[model samples]
Target chain A: MSTHARPRIGEQHCQECLVSIGPERIREEFPTLWTKVHGKPLVYLDNAATTQKPRSVIEALTRYYTEENSNVHRGVHLLSQVATQAYESGRTKVRQFVNAAHDREIIFTRGTTEGINLVAQTYGRRALRAGDEVLISAMEHHSNIVPWQMICEEKGAALKVIPMNDAGELLLEEYRRLLTDRTKLVAVTHVSNALGTVNPIQDVIALAHGRGIPVLVDGAQAVSHMPVDVRELDCDFYAFSGHKLFGPTGIGILYGKAYLLEAMPPYQGGGDMISAVTFEKTIYNTLPYKFEAGTPHIAGVIGLAAAIEYVERVGRNQIAAYEADLLAYGTEILTAVPGLRLIGTARDKAGVLSFVLDGIHAHDVGTILDLEGVAVRAGHHCAMPVMKRFGLPATARASLAFYNTRADLDALAKGLHKVREVFA
Target chain B: MSDLRELYQQVILDHYKRPRNFKKLDGATRQAEGNNPLCGDQITVYLHMDGDLIRDISFEGAGCAISQSAASLMTTVLKGKTKAEAGALFEKFHEMVTGGENAVDPMELGKLAVFCGVKEFPVRVKCASLPWHTMRAALEGQNGSVSTE
Candidate 1:
């Protein structure tokens, strides 16, 4: 309960100290991890799909619904005022979390997919002209790709993909070549969900900015694993989901630069987004409110703030170091399994291990792993382009999180052994 | 491991390892592609029919053990059966995998009974039935593609 008492994670001496406290302390906070599945202890490795919520986040949801459950923005009464204050404070927490320049730059959304679609429809629809190109990467999730595709198709713009190497790292040289005068916007993922390749987003942003192109980052997989500073990266827009960060589902944040968001049209027209209304001409609300239409997910925002606080308390630097060590151990152990070929081998990777067994389909591998109480995602992972790049129909993915330990990876290895045995 | 063993019986594994009639028909009267987008499993069924009777049936595809074995076993039982019989078989097979009430008798299913274990895994029902769905599509002259969404 006392986070301040722990040694500062980045200090040289505290690395071992955090290691000593280890995942046991962290795992205790997540109640679901302790549960059994298929008569065995659950080895939950599907973090990239969605993370397990900690007690603090769960309790935050409970607290919100039990006490401060009221509509936000328009309420003039005491409960409404309290709910509005809490909701706005959640926005401020998000601003601080991503280190956005202003609170008004943070827009509450229905997860990362909605956030990407918002910018693609509003900013992309406006800026794109005939024959213009919107550059995205090959490793992008379907969420990032499809929105741009829809907007581009509508605006008579073509979607250009920045190709990746065999190891799943983006080809920066090819990316540089793709950026040109005709390119209107750049959308890319900070970390690939399927491959776990931690993209060089700083370099990506710089290359796009050099061409005077605005960049939007899909940080759904990055926010929980590493510290993100929107100002430091200089990305014009960054979107992330709360569920992926151990918070409740149906809520996320889209951080855009103030000027860009001000210029863009509203994504949806509903109650909270309007300031003054008339049948003839209605005036829109200002800044973030202009984007967040209808009644917001008040409890999800509160829970997301709690999840952010929980992650901050654990220290992202320490979590990164711990997960890196675990990844190395995982890579070694998983490679030792005969016929297990890893799909992504990027030098700078975090949070996922996607692979395919020699003679086993990923669907079969998944069913076998589930029997051993090791949960993993097995499919194209909504990144069919990446699947086609490797000439694979599907790959079994075991994604990581800060709460996971070497023991969990060991269980995954054991499960793969069972998979091989079944196939043999 | 009882449930696992039941689901992945030796017979099913054998069929998956060496599928029978796993070839494309050169002069096929009917064909249909089946896709299970959830698992990326795809199968193309080819049939050579003569006057409402299946003279030769085969499948060419790649997928999991359940799906591959199901397709392999299906081709074995369906040869020479009438189009109406194939339709009835599809219903019975669907009911078997879904564990519906009054599930078809295992003895009646013959080799196809091995797939009865598929009922335990609801998510995989599509994998076990993809080939059958594709086969049904081929029979109906629905030539394009079918998806078990």
Candidate 2:
């Protein structure tokens, strides 16, 4: 078997001269997004949970399983080499996607949850001394909070919370006050998954940097909706999941600064992450390889790269603009319904509308909406603290993607009326 | 589908709207809180036990129509029955709502006949039985809140 030229992603699958995607193209490409639920055209507004995959991403996974099904970076055969190249290209794509300085900084994990746990167990456990504090926001998802709690608990370090105001925006003044000599690390979400508040991460990072404290930004909710530049933010660490970005589940990116990753211990000990294994003393692999233990999700990486490419082709600016319109439209229409109360009204928010109907539980609203083929999440949204902050049990949330339309919001509005009718 | 209709029948809605015995029992012999973590629904069952017979009962909580109404109906049926009878009723009701192969007759359930629609929705079975489970916990004297994970 001969080593061929560089990994090309099989050009026939993706034409190089492809046009940038718009909302129209998104509708046409995502056949599942337009599926009929209960004989009604599916109006999916649960994008925050997971974005629907484009045709390219699905095909990428299909092609990988069909042709390039082999272990990466080990075998001398052509298939293994091709798979390794594709996987490496995935890392490069992730690096560029987040504007990281180097591909070596990227580590693959299960998703946002595992990424946080990785940092918590490795960097957090190693760096934090007793009486030290790890500060997080009130609006953070449980994934962002629980891992820190677990690590802080084990390390005998305290977990401090940055409270938010009624609008669901983190109180920066309070955050400034919370900062002290003992504040070892600050973990904040780039955009709140529950409240949809886009945090002032740059300002947060600068403040932490002043105190000589490193910050970890949870970018799971923000990456799909906006452009992220780790170099621009100068954050020590950033993490995001692939499923939320229209790729397969069980794959995510954890992009840390190289120096920090070097100092931290490897997350897990397993194969592909070892330079040499010995009974007495085993040496870990360098940079990324050290962090990426075991056989990685080869197909997932390729699919994620495809998803990132699809996002790139769609033009982040175009997607952002379209989603903004949808958000405005959704807010206005959802607000018009009688007795409806919007939960999070932060000035800076992503494409999420969380609300409650008077005298009706969110679960009831969700059940009624499901009959009409409108999918919206009605629960604490894995952000129990956010729900607690608002003094609510749960809220009905409709989060948007570029593919979602004003008509979908209308379906939601119509469905809410049925909810009211049932109670009335 | 008519499943929604069956799940939210007028009787269930009426019970939800104006629940029977939905006041805090100030002097309760036993009590247990039931919480559905998924929906953030909470129900507390208060049993005033007099020997084997439940002399009086009341409840107070907030939840979906199915859960609240089921709790209300539970409080009503459990008033005159002995502890053993309530336990039997709970078992029969559980089987009816979960659509067990040993399903009870709808006529046997009476007002609970409306809950026959709940059998179709496996997820909501917890909603319908949260109060019954809480009452069982209250009787058995569990330490803390009962959660339907």
The best candidate in terms of TM-score: 1
Write down the TM-score of every candidate.
Answer: 0.97, 0.95
- Badly placed stretches (over 4 Å) of model 1 are A1-17
Question: For this target, which candidate reaches the highest DockQ against the unseen true structure?
Answer: 1
Candidate 1 chain A worst ten-residue window by lDDT: A6-15
Per residue, candidate 2 scores C-alpha lDDT tens digits across A123-225 of 9989888899999999889999999999888889999999989998889999999999999999999998888889999999999999999999999999988
Model 1: per-residue Cα lDDT over A1-424, one tens digit each: 3244543322334335347766776787789999999899999999999999988888888888988899998889988998999899999999998899899999999999999999999999899999999999999999999999999889899999999999999999999999999999999999999999999999999998998999999999999888999999999999999999999999999999999999999999998899999999889999889998899999999999988887777777877888899899999999999999999999999989999999899999999999999999999999999999999999999999988989999999998998889889
Residue-wise C-alpha lDDT for candidate 1, range B38-136, written one tens digit per residue: 888889999999989999999999989999999999999999999999998899999999999976887778889999889999999999999999999
Return the lDDT, model 2, position A266: 90
lDDT of 1 at A9: 28
Each prediction's RMSD over C-alphas, in Å, is 2.6, 3.8
TM-score of chain A of 1: 0.96
